[model samples]
Target: MRRVIMLRALVWSVLLFVVSFGCAQERDPIVRIQANALSKAFFVGDLKDPTDDPEFYLRATVVDVASGAGSDGLFTNSDAQPTVRVRFEITEDMLLARLTYERID
Candidate 1:
């Protein structure tokens, strides 16, 4: 009885550890940028964990610069200087924005 109980506990502990590690690896990348009138063009630079995926899909949200109100869409001149939140995922066919502006960093 004692050996059976210990084996069951060990199996459960291993299962939990494996699940937590898998969850940690599935985290997507989220990039934030300031999209004002002057700085409208931006790009995604080298990611920390680079992938060989050819294309990617992005979800962005724009927040009003003055009142802190936010909406789900691209940046526009309507806001004076808004904050843009971009979250991207690697995909096979979905193509997101192309990086035209060169970033020197």
Candidate 2:
């Protein structure tokens, strides 16, 4: 009896784990954007909820960016590059992302 109960518990545990993992993987879609000097603003519109039962949400993050020499003495002789700032605006119907650049001297 003890062994049978243990087996049933293990099977249910593995089934629960698999179902939760699958649901997590399907929850979000990953998107990547590469920006350059000539890059233009991006917009995504007409997004529809996959299921009305679940709440809808959108998230954005600037993960990494290129760096240049600075007067802080990190790389004095290295070539300088323009610094960029990214801006994001999210609305009910649209998502907008824009980039602006400034020379570091």
Candidate 1 per-residue C-alpha lDDT over 1-105 given as tens digits, one digit per residue, 9 for 90 to 100: 999999999999999999998888655677564555322112323444434323334334344355665654435544454333333443456525543235466
TM-score of each: 0.30, 0.27
lDDT string for model 2 (50-69, tens) is 12222223334345435863
Model 2 error, position 37 (Å):
17
> What ranges in model 2 sit over 4 Å off?
26-105
lDDT of each: 0.51, 0.50
Instruction: Give the worst 10-residue stretch by lDDT in candidate 2.
Output: 38-47
Best by TM-score: 1
Query: Quick one: RMSD of model 1?
Result: 15.3
| Residue 73 shift from truth in candidate 2, angstroms | 49
C-alpha positional error of residue 67 in candidate 1 after TM-score superposition, expressed in Å: 18
Model 1 poorest 10 in a row by lDDT: 37-46
